[model samples]
Target: MGEVKVVFQSVDEVMDYLKALEGYSGDLDLQCDHMIVDGKSLLGILSLGVNRLLNLQIYSDNYEELIKKIEFCCRG
Candidate 1:
């Protein structure tokens, strides 16, 4: 498993992020505090609220390409 920190600034950003995540075949989850949601679900992502950094856990060994695609939202 791999992890990355990302922040969504708006609803549009969340939509875009989910679009980028569509290509991922492995299990992907977005977590904030105690809430965890499916990374690919638009509603799930939006439920976490925006403009705050969140933890993304990617459960796959070949996730480098997926990471690169979503790196635009990565927080440092």
Candidate 2:
């Protein structure tokens, strides 16, 4: 699995991020504190609260393409 921290500045960003995630066949999840939700679900991602860095867990070894697609949203 691969992990990264990302932040959604607006609803559009969230939508775009979800779109990127949906293209991948691997499992993707977003976590906030003790809460975890499906990354591809618009409602699930919106429920995580905005303007905060979220922990993204990509559950697959062959997730390089997916990661590259969403790297713009990731924070170093």
For each candidate in turn, the TM-score is 0.92, 0.91
Candidate 1, residues 1-76, lDDT tens digits: the string is 8899999989988878878877568998999999999988888888899988899999999778888998888896
Local distance difference test, each candidate: 0.87, 0.86
TM-score of 1: 0.92
- Candidate 2 residue runs with Cα over 4 Å from true position: none
Residue 71, candidate 1: how far off, in angstroms? 0.9
Compared with the true structure, the alpha-carbon lDDT of candidate 2 equals 0.86
Tens digits of per-residue lDDT for model 2, 1-76: 8898989999999988877766577888999999999988889999998898899998999867777898879996
